[model samples]
Target: MSYVGWMIFGVVLLVIEILTPTFFFLWFSIAAFLSGILAMFGLNLGWQVSVFAVASTLLVIFTRPIAKKIMGEAPRKVYVEELKNGVATVVQDIDSSKGTGIVKISGENWRALSVDPKKVIKKGEEVVIERIEGTTVYVRPIETEAKKEGEEI
Candidate 1:
């Protein structure tokens, strides 16, 4: 192709790369621009293709890691532990032996269960929210510790 033709192709590809916002076409556009430069210098088809390939490969391989570092790592979603504790209301009777229940905390309902198997809690009883296991909240009877401090047992 003529020098002018190659330059026009390069410019079109570069514009397309900009519109698409992907780094992929940008490399090929750079290659095409280099090919156009080679054409302007009287290089033939075989030499132009070789230069474009080598330059594009080197640009991608050298720049990818640097680009990743500059962009930084993708932000991860916050875990459930980040939310406040001690504010959940029992939505279902938590049977420790049955191992199933639900609670509503911060306007979001969550599956819940007693962490201890021996404690049997009734419905409408306020409980302390404990650690999360998967999507379930593991709970214990509230004031149990305080009650224990006052009594012998």
Candidate 2:
């Protein structure tokens, strides 16, 4: 392909990188740009192709990790300890017997289970997280002030 063709291919790859952002295509795009430069200098087809391949491979091997590290880790998971005792709103009926529930806490939804398997926490009820086992949080219904006062009376 001509220099212009290689440059357009680079632009296409850049567009793909922007759209998906897997950090896989950016190096290829850069390699294509480099190849375009070589092509502009009257390099033959074999040299242009060779430069693209070598540049792409080297950039991916050497720079992808650095780029990913600079971008930082994916959103950090909320610590289990931090979530313990935190109040959450039940978003789905928590039926421990059926093994299904969802709760919203800290602006994220999470799978939840009742601390007591026989207990069913209904949707919209408030619950306190007792513990987390893997991705599931064990929880219990938060006692209302009325219930507490009645118990005291």
Candidate 3:
């Protein structure tokens, strides 16, 4: 094919690649352009097809890893230390051994557990969130005696 024909094919494929965003079909288009280059060099149809197929396959295999590295890992949603040592009020009595209850923290109610399963906590009591397990917060009674005096309760 002529150089102008190959350039047109390349431009059309690139446009399709942009519209679809699949990262596929674009390779075959690139292959066609490469075959066009080979054709310009007077390669026959069979040789041109072979060169295109090999070049396209190599492009895909090599570009994929580079693309992933450039993109890096997918961004992960993170929950900060919002609950760590943060105080929560028990909204429901927690029987840790039986495994579930609710606590109200920062105006949001969350399922809770006693990090120490041996303890049973009562409703309306303040607790310290120890850790988060999935959506549930594990907690323990806040030590109040240390601040029982004039230390802000």
The best candidate in terms of lDDT? 2
Give the alpha carbon lDDT tens digit for every residue of 1-153 in model 2: 899999999999999999994799999999999999999999999999999999999999999899999888878877879999999999999999999999999999999999999999999999999999999999999999997999999
lDDT of 3 by residue, 1-153 (tens): 565576687789888988974676678688878888878888877787688779889988887677667767765544548668999999999998787689998778889999889899999999998889789999998867765665774
TM-score of each: 0.45, 0.61, 0.43
Better of 1 and 2 by lDDT: 2
When 1 and 3 are scored with TM-score, the better candidate is 1
Give, for candidate 2, the lowest lDDT window spanning 10 residues. Answer: 71-80
Give lDDT tens digits, candidate 1, residues 1-153. 877887887789889878973466677778888998999999999999898889889888888677668768856654687643675678888876787788877777878888787776676777777788788888877766777888865
Rank order by TM-score, top first?
Answer: 2, 1, 3
**Which residue pairs overlap in candidate 1's backbone?**
none
Clashing pairs in 3: none
